[model samples]
Target: MSSHSHHTIRQAILDRIQTGEWALGELIPGEAMLADEYGCARTTINRALQGLANDGVVIRKRKGGTRVCDMPVRQAKFNIPVVREQVEALGSVYRHQVTRRVEKAPPTAVQKRLGLAPGTKSLQLDTVHLADDRPFAFETRWVNTRAVPAILDAPLDEISANEWLVQTVPFSSGDVVFCAVNAGKDVAEALGAREGAAVFVIDRTTSLAGEFITTMQLYYREGYQLHSQL
Candidate 1:
């Protein structure tokens, strides 16, 4: 099949869903059946289904197959930019440093966010990203070892965790929240800003299937703003 066939199939399936031919909570045909109907390979149908699943239009299960979501949560799709890319896009030298790496029981807040058991252990990383030899952002992240064990052996000192995870991991669903907060002592020191100064905060959580992957909070120094176009 041609490369554009998947896009055609994706649009066809989306039209079916939007037109109510595939009603909510209805189990659609499996990939093999769809491929037979469309005269394409099963892999192509799987790709289309995956795209729908990623956009929250459908839900997929290993044994239960794919189904229309009862309440489809439309996702605002955007590329998760790597820290190095964000810095270099502004014509600045990008640098990364790993300040701390440890395996320990996560704090109550993180545990609650990841839906971990009481005694779950996670890999915590503290990193500072630099642009042109100046502090850019301070990052505190927790990786669910059970979901992504390969992260334990990664060389984070050479690559920021944000950059590495974006390149290596395949997350099915995630959410990001942005806010403004007053920098505390540690954050202030890391970003070379005065304590209590206003800082931009980005909190993100990623998951694959039903398993948690990582949760991170990034603190950007004063005057930082995130710009994007739809």
Candidate 2:
């Protein structure tokens, strides 16, 4: 409102979101309404709101409008996507490598998260997300065969489920959590880091059309950081 300060607008929007004054999935007021409330011009409100959406603090749709999220986890707020686009943002080449793939029974922990009964069939995919051939993330993903049964027979070495999902699937809801974990032998090898090193782990569960789709764990090297403005 006062010369379009990022700090001012971000705090105001965040206060509303945290206070539950704006519930998740509820459309935000239009720019005109916000301008009236904030005592600012429509341009200022537009700039403020646009910055919030870009920072993953809000979801903006052309006709659907902006809405608050159900699970407002800050780490889960942004979609990091593949490292290729990230590195390319700084003018670097993106690279990828598939380490392994196996169709096997889902682990007990994975089964519980997917709400699957014990001994459900699943496919495990291990991959290294790289930037300019340097390890960026160690990703171990489990695809629920019941959700996408054909994954069992597909050549996972050629394409990642993350890539495929962007094209074919639409998620209804998601559960995401982030934590710090020690890089064990498997994780070290995948991320090209030393064993026992500290890494950031992001676990994501995606649902499509109200049904469980897949659950994935993404591990990033120590230096990796999630950044945002507003």
Residue range 136-217, candidate 2, lDDT tens digits: 8888888877666656655555666666554334344688888999999999988889999999998889864344778998
Distance from true location, Cα of 26 in model 2, Å: 24
What TM-scores do the predictions have? 0.69, 0.62
**CA error at residue 183 for candidate 2, angstroms:** 0.8
Residue pairs of candidate 1 with colliding backbone atoms: none
Candidate 1 lDDT (Cα, whole model)? 0.81
Q: Candidate 1, TM-score vs. the true structure?
A: 0.69
RMSD of each: 10.8, 13.2
Per-residue lDDT for 136 in model 1? 95
For model 1, residues 110-207, the per-residue Cα lDDT tens digits are 99878799899999999999999899999999999877677787788877889777655555577889899999999999999999999999989876
